[model samples]
Target: MSKVFRSLLLITALSSVSQWAQAGNYWKATAKDGWLDGYVEATLLLNGNLDATSIDTDVDNGVVTLRGKVETDTDKALVQELVLGVDGVNGIENMLTVFSPGENEDSAIQRKLTDKKVATVVKTRLLVAPDIGSTKIDVNSSQGVVVLEGQVKNDAEKQRAVEIAKKITDVEQVVNKLTVSD
Candidate 1:
């Protein structure tokens, strides 16, 4: 065989091998993604707390994307947590919106009323506490989460404000954004 012919044949063989390896890798990635998609879907469906019928799961490489609407913020977070627990999931794109079908105008008004009541109770407690400077602290509540924003005389006062908010009835969580001015 001519030297030039041999060189051409060798190049062709290397190219074919390279293409085969690339194709194999592509298929492997695709298969893995498919498996992950099914696994994620099954996980969501198995969770009794989640209504996964409206949710869509898409997996590419090792990343999973969850798109759809959840009943509440808690459900949205839960979905992300559940998908992230999957063995091969590198990351999650949670595009879930919170849309509660059962929450009518009355329910929304009730939630707002509860939040307002929580805030009022917390503020009253802070104001009555002699040791803390309550005037400088601002309290806000939403969906049972109380947020304390503003400045305090010291760390002790800040701690006291947080404790007061936490003790309030219907306050699910307290977020302290109080800065110590003293």
Candidate 2:
């Protein structure tokens, strides 16, 4: 090969290597975000004061986003503090809203009943679906929001569960926390 061709080939090889290195870094950052999400979830599950089902966490590029409702302001603060303890979490955006205290007893009861009904309907749909094994899944609903927590065999099962829940009437949102088994 001529000198010019040899130098051009060397430059092309270096460019390819640089691209691969950048891709690897991107993958590592993504994996770190996933790990942080899992850590926050597990911590919430273990906490006695915070209801894990009522809180959802998402992490992207090390920034954590907390969404959902809590019963009290103290619970909201507690969740924020607990999430800050997780390593690799660059920051937390706490979007948790406290349940309003102005509601009367009758309204609260009605809302509870409606939520229960929604949960029951979602569960029934999941049980009847041909692809989903409803035995391993748990469903909860509050204020038209459905929360699904359980382990499934694969990604297909997880997506099926979420779709089933979303199909239920009165279900305003579906928070899927389903895990795939190894």
Candidate 3:
């Protein structure tokens, strides 16, 4: 065989191998993303307050993009919390718009600010509480109502989450949706 021909053949073989590797990596990423998306959707469906049909989920490189509208800000926060618990999820992009037709922009912004403040305070309280595993807790607030969701090691942790949330000022109500791990 001519030396030039051998060189060309070698280059072609290397190129083919590189393309195959790239394709394999792409497929693996896609399959992993698909699995993560399914897991997040399943978790949302299991939550009674969430209408999974109204929310759309897409996963790319382990980052979840949530699109569509939820009934309240609490529902939007709930969706974020649920997706965060899924194993493969690295981050969440919550594009969920709270559906409030009658409320004007100013009022809506104010309400969101209040909810955020309440959520922040409660989360800080949970973080400082030695008895509660703050890492396992998810907090969401809407219109001064706080919702606590996640798994705790014992009933004491669950009750402690509720207590901390109740103690926060401007918290209209505390909804304890935490589950105790066996």
Candidate 4:
């Protein structure tokens, strides 16, 4: 009976220690995430190209979520790029929308904005696609036409890139100038 009581106490102590260790880890992760959030916000504020006033940033376990509107798609992509450069940023969920107030959709300015948005979207999709070397590809858009240029690892990759660009809304045509690499 005495030995059984001692064993029970030992087990309870071990369980308590395990719980404390887990709680400590949680607090450490939370603190790290908070630090990363501040760093990301400061980085955005310091960038001249970004209007950080309209942006909202949140960080969780090293992942950052950006919610807001930007003047152009270039600005949206730029935000993600800048945040990704921050130390400890594991990933990003970019929810930025391109918006220009008081502009008519049919107007030339609006058309240019749409074109830029299409280009940015295509470039981002290519960058995220599996097995695609997006760094080697240059994406451009003008008047609803998208041009893909650069070297691809194989013909299949070239075809995949063209298909991805073509599927994007507002992309009326996809001109593939991708060379198959040796």
Task: Name the top lDDT candidate.
Answer: 4
Give stretches of model 2 more than 4 Å off: 101-182
Q: What is the C-alpha lDDT profile of model 2 across 91-134, one tens digit per residue? A: 99999987853243477775675676567656655765688764
Per-residue accuracy of model 4 over 87-181 as CA lDDT, tens digit each? 68999999887796434345787677667767866776687678686479999999989999999999889999999888777789999999998
Model 1: lowest-lDDT 10 consecutive positions: 101-110
TM-score, every prediction: 0.55, 0.52, 0.59, 0.58
Error of 1 at 44 (Å): 0.2
Q: Candidate 3 regions off by >4 Å? A: 101-182
**Which whole-number lDDT from 0 to 100 does residue 91 have in model 4?**
96
Error of 2 at 145 (Å): 37
State model 4's lDDT.
Answer: 0.82
Candidate numbers, best lDDT first, in rank order:
4, 1, 3, 2
Assess the local accuracy of residue 103 in candidate 4 as a C-alpha lDDT between 0 and 100.
42
What lDDT would candidate 3 get against the real structure? 0.80
Inter-residue clash pairs, candidate 1: none
Error of 4 at 155 (Å): 1.5
Q: State each model's C-alpha RMSD to the native.
A: 12.5, 13.4, 7.9, 5.7
- Give a tens-digit lDDT track for model 1, residues 1-182: 69999999999999999999999999999999999899889877876556889999999889998898977654665677567656789999888888864355477875775666567667756866777975988889999899999988898999989987887667899999999885
The best candidate by TM-score is 3
Which model is ahead, 3 or 4, in terms of TM-score? Answer: 3
